[model samples]
Target: MNINVERQKMADRLFLVAVEGEIDVYTAPVLKKELLPLTEISGTGVTLDLSRTVYIDSTALGVIIAALKSAARNRCRFSVVGMSPRVERLFTITGLMEILRREKIAEGDN
Candidate 1:
């Protein structure tokens, strides 16, 4: 599994976290540790990129929700992007799509 975090310490302070492979119970903690710090930085917005992720279990979802809550408390913007079809289905089934912002894939692109 590969987890990459990109933080822009500029006006608006954009933070992008990208994850590859499965994000299950074991991997969720690693993600949590990485995600939590984004909220600590002053003036930040977070974008979680799951474009390369193969799977995400309930635990992983919980961790993400927690981060969203933290972003709210800190008054920082938060959104998620690059969701695969399976992941998108899971989020839809779980009703998480209502709360999380997902970047739309352009037509004619995989």
Candidate 2:
């Protein structure tokens, strides 16, 4: 499947990536390329909004986990938000929900 990834800088220290469509092996690399750089922004906070995502696989999860680790090493805050029920269940099943900071972003509240 395919995915569309868009980004917005919410503030001097806040960055956001909005993803739509499936996050599978095919699309995971795109996400990694976009997300890893954001994590390198020292002292910044990076958020991944997956509200519109329809699917995710292990490869996608790995990309996110790598980004999370990179963020930690760079002193950046990384959060994953707006997960649909199915996606949230995956996170729970994988025990990543406990590790990831899950928060919802209100419309226009960035």
Candidate 3:
């Protein structure tokens, strides 16, 4: 799995993390390590772009949910973006789309 991080500075910090490959039990920890910290900063906005992510398992989903909760606690803005069709379906089926505030972008656009 590959994770790329970008940060934008303004009145509030914006963190954009792009992921490629599968997010499973093995890779979830890596992603969690990279994302969890951003949730600690108040007014920090996090956008997790999964445009290239091929697959995601339950563990990864749990990690993402945890990140969202942390962001809420810290008053950060968290959003999930660019989910592939299959991943988007998974979120839809699990009723996580609304809770996660996920955004679906065209496959090639991101």
Candidate 4:
């Protein structure tokens, strides 16, 4: 299936982008579109809520990584929250978790 993207302004500088459904090749661009611009703004804290997301392909993963990198470069905070067990395993086994751990981005998960 496609995806649904919902954005929320949590604070003056904190934005929450909640993605539901599947994030695959076709839908990854949508996720990127919603995410990259937020990272471009300096000091913007972007939290990606994936609680409702059930599936994500490699393209989507790459988009997420790129967003995180952009957030790091722009000095904006980026973190992911409420990942499902399957998706969480993908992040862990692919070493993306290590990359996230090493990067000085994203604040508390809460």
lDDT of 4 by residue, 6-74 (tens): 989998999999999999998999999888899999988999988999999899899989998798799
Taking the tens digit of each residue's C-alpha lDDT, what string does model 3 give over 1-110?
A: 55444444434488777777888888888888888898888988888888878999999889888888898899988878788879988887887875654433123322
Query: Scored by CA lDDT, what does every candidate get?
Result: 0.74, 0.84, 0.76, 0.86
List TM-score per model, in order: 0.80, 0.89, 0.81, 0.91
Which candidate achieves the best lDDT against the true structure? 4
- Residue 32, model 4: lDDT of 91
Error of 1 at 52 (Å): 0.5
User: lDDT: which is higher, 3 or 4?
Assistant: 4
Q: Which is better, 2 or 3, measured by TM-score?
A: 2
Model 4, runs deviating above 4 Å: 104-110
Model 3 CA lDDT for position 90: 86
Between candidates 1 and 2, which one is better according to TM-score? Answer: 2
C-alpha lDDT of candidate 1 relative to the true structure: 0.74
lDDT of 3 at 47: 80
How far residue 81's Cα lies from its native spot in candidate 3, in Å, is 0.6
For model 2, how does the per-residue alpha-carbon lDDT over 83-106 read when each residue is reduced to its tens digit?
888988898799777676343222
Where in model 1 is the C-alpha error above 4 Å?
1-12, 101-110
